[model samples]
Target chain A: MVRWEPGTAERLQKVALELFATRGYEQTTAAEIAQAVGLTERTFFRHFSDKREVLFQGQELLVQAFLDGIEAAPEDASPFEVVACALRSAATFFPDERRPHSRTRQSVIDRNPALQEREHHKLTTLATTVATALRARGVDDVAATLAAESGATVFGIAFTRWLREERSLADIAAEVLAELLTLAARALRPAR
Target chain B: MVRWEPGTAERLQKVALELFATRGYEQTTAAEIAQAVGLTERTFFRHFSDKREVLFQGQELLVQAFLDGIEAAPEDASPFEVVACALRSAATFFPDERRPHSRTRQSVIDRNPALQEREHHKLTTLATTVATALRARGVDDVAATLAAESGATVFGIAFTRWLREERSLADIAAEVLAELLTLAARALRPAR
Candidate 1:
């Protein structure tokens, strides 16, 4: 059995991401990632199932943040407000220091169809998690789904822009949420 | 070259879906689908690249309907109005007669990860297409994306319910859109 290591996972993720960025995700192998971090292949498997999982390690933490934020919001909060708050809370998971890594990770994902599909699936899961959280908050099915999906959309748009622009994730998310609300207002206006 | 055959693609899709529903998607093979339709495998290849394409054949027509609806909307229509109109127009693509087929298709897709990923990709493509149409109508990027993504979200919610509920697709879609607008309104209101 491999001995317990404090930063093994983080070290592995860093080395794997660098390798993926330099040599391409397809060109990189799990053994190379493990060796780069001075760990055995078995040790790498103990931390991550595969090389692709390094980029997705934070998904669970992000989901927890979203759920906690939603559950902690005021009882009177609107569905959209709860969603917005949850997204804003989740934004804390991605520090500005991680932006460069995120940009590289996204570039890698964009080049690979499998990664793109995984990313889409991740987003879908995130939306479903948020929807479930909303339902727990007494929101109905349609409203919960709408709010959760809308929040996920706002998060995606903001995350994309945030990767390219010099803005805080929270600010970007807030701006996108407001923009969506404005569009929704315009759409709701009675036909002239 | 294989001679053009009337309704061959439809017949193949019908057989493929039936086989998928009864025998399971993974258990159903392309050869089996072709054989069931009384056609050679080569003939099946002429219509669909693979078994999955049989389920996604309507995507193109739906996209076209969305584009056409956006293009034909009154020049003064808002981005959201154009999207709402486009979705309403696309509803005609899913006539009542097609509901049973769609239900079966969705069940097959839900049980398979690959099919689910394809469905998500298809939705993403639909959103992108709607965004492009809105941009062509002089809508700004951010607003167009918001409207387009929102429209896709509404379509997903409405379509899911329409599959299980007795209401017409158009009515369900309109109601979901209205519900989203209402949620947006409440979220836009200042916190008490």
Candidate 2:
């Protein structure tokens, strides 16, 4: 969807979230969203199933990109390194210029409880997809799940930092993975 | 909500989840859910706002319990110790007999995309709240947030394992935290 009509789809997402933040999720309709974006209802429906999906348009791509990154990792990389590479790959997935739209999409998600739930589902899907990718690369069982999950956790911190801090996504991700390692070390204190 | 109504509300939740799984969330109504559970529509409304709320009833208490655990920790405990204690507090927050309902709740949540997102928001909220709690306990800025998020990350792995695996929640949390720490130690090795 982003590839087809990047600007229109992103603009719809931004306008929809703004409306969702101010006017509320259910109260706002497809027409209202399209009008705000200067698009027709048919154009709106072309990109989104309904108003709720505007927040989730790029989800499929994100999940696929995560899998692709894992599969594309260097053969010598450890499972953790493979996951770290996936986090780095996410840097190119979303356009940096579209932070405002991304922020608005988040705002709408924050305001709407249902949309918030869907967002979690999206991440979980990404995590599972990641795990599958890892398994394909010969890392199986709990390790795959854990690595994939670890990747998602790192991704969450990175994305949050990207939202709040004045840094590139890669730096934010690197910082999070580093801190996560520190915490994980602290968590594994030998029984004393 | 759990402290007050307990089983009646839980019964509604289970029944609603079954209905939602079978009939779809959009097709299911409050009256139908109430009928299946032998409760009145009025009682159903009392317990939940909509079909979705039924899926996320007890998570708030879980987050609250995490906060309480952090606040109740000894004066000199490190931020990591405080977060670990908070994760341990879930044992007291949920009773032993409630385990079945616990899995059922997770199953229902797993089946529904929307419910999963709500669960994720609750998790992110829990992490932030725990970080804020640690700050109040005298931990400084980046360290406090890092500790909180790391705890949240470990807790997530623990919680996900607890829900899926037959092991006790406390046990899985302890193991994941331990393993994550080992992983982090390896990651933090200084470059030659």
Evaluate model 1: give its TM-score. Answer: 0.93
Model 1 lDDT per residue over A53-146, tens place: 9878868878888888898788999999998889878888877877988998898899898898788788889999999989988999999999
Q: TM-score of every model?
A: 0.93, 0.71
Q: What C-alpha RMSD does candidate 1 show over the true interface residues after superposing them?
A: 0.8
Over A91-190, each residue of candidate 2 has an lDDT whose tens digit, in order, gives 6675566676677667777877767667766766787888888888887546677677778867876786687666788877877777666655655566
Tell me how many clashing residue pairs each candidate has.
Answer: 0, 4
lDDT accuracy of residue B115 in candidate 1? 90
Question: In model 2, where do residues sit more than 4 Å from their true spots?
Answer: A1-39, A52-55, A94-96, A100-117, A189-192, B1-61, B72-76, B94-125, B140-153, B156-167, B190-192
Cα-based lDDT for every prediction = 0.87, 0.74
Residues forming the 10-long window of minimal summed lDDT in candidate 1 chain A: A1-10
Model 1 chain B scores worst on lDDT over the 10 consecutive residues at: B1-10
Compared with the real two-chain complex, what DockQ does model 2 have? 0.30
